[model samples]
Target: MTFSIIGRCQESGQLGIAISSSSIAVGARCPWVRAGVGAVATQNVTLPALGPQILDLLETKQFDPQSALDHALGANDYSEYRQVTVIDTNGRTAFFSGKEALGIYTAVAGEQCVAAGNMLAGTHVIEAMVPAFQNTQGSLADRLLAAMHAAMTAGGEAGPVHSAALKIAGDPIWPIVDLRVDWADDDPIGQLDSLWQAYRPQMQDYVTRALNPTAAPSYGVPGNE
Candidate 1:
């Protein structure tokens, strides 16, 4: 029902998440992230509580990626129907794919990133996402968008995706950039990437307004943080 990519940016110290799903309103059900904490993708049977619970664990420094995931998985009975990936603030990453998950899914961790997805066409789908993000250079949001594009090009979910979203959180407030194509035509991934790119400048402008109000354009100036 869903395919997601969750990770933290090594350079900006920001966290980014992207997801696409054949089910309507995918963003509402999957993909959760918090800056200065960690990121999580909960799918399959879906455990929404794990999203904030994992972030709380990371925030208190009570556990690392592996242990936090272990603790969360240990406390849940539906572990077999769950898929979760975590990338902590320090860049440490880990993930678990339930044995009962649909189709094929794998979570891969590298020096600075983690990539995970299910119901993909093949193993290369997730494999291509991370390397593509690593090989590409720019903002963390751009890299995440690239990863999503790579997965889609490699054959995303077994069926057409109805919804897609990208979330990046950092200092000051909730999220620095958040965009969602809750429902789209046949090409949700491509449309998601386009929305991300269009929103980048606005994000920068908003940040600028936060830090230096005079520098922001009258209309571009964002509200009080």
Candidate 2:
């Protein structure tokens, strides 16, 4: 069981997804985002391939979120077992929760943001994330993480979530933020947020190292020093 939020930042045009699940290594399966394309989260029965496939439709195939979702799910024999959500460059969102989605499933679509979950505690689990994503201050990563925390407070999955991930795509060829707590017997969501906190201040430095090594800052580690 999993719950996730996908959002596009209005000011930066960045896309991000924050997700947590009862399953192990959930990050390795769900939550995909491309810098200039879009974001997608495929859960429920969890066909991991659908993440990249839907992103392809949004990028090269000239498909909107809704069309891409329709085309992707339409082709799958087990489509009814999937719960997928999509958001594109234009801030449009599309979400589908198949009939066979796990217990107490629901979704919420908000401005430039959307969230969905299967085996959630209730619809409020999805509903609470919307306003948190909308009103939270800071970067897109910050807001996405905030929404994730809100989901837990609102009553998360029908069961305790053991794994979590949050990813954000900026202008770089690589992800600006990709943090995961693959499996935590305790609170994976909190651990994921703590990672974001540790990573945020250094995010730009990593990009600088990649794009222009000479201009990058010191690593502040033993060998690097």
- The top-ranked prediction according to TM-score is 2
| Native-referenced Cα lDDT, model 2 | 0.91
Candidate 2 Cα deviation (angstroms), residue 109: 0.6
Task: Give me the runs in candidate 2 sitting further than 4 Å from their true place.
Answer: 222-225
TM-score each candidate: 0.91, 0.97
Candidate 2 on 35-120: residue-level lDDT in tens? 98999999999998888889989887578899999999887779989999999988999999999999999889999999999898
Candidate 2 least-lDDT 10 residues: 216-225
Over the full model, what C-alpha lDDT does candidate 1 score relative to the true structure?
Answer: 0.81
Clash count, predicted structure 2: 0
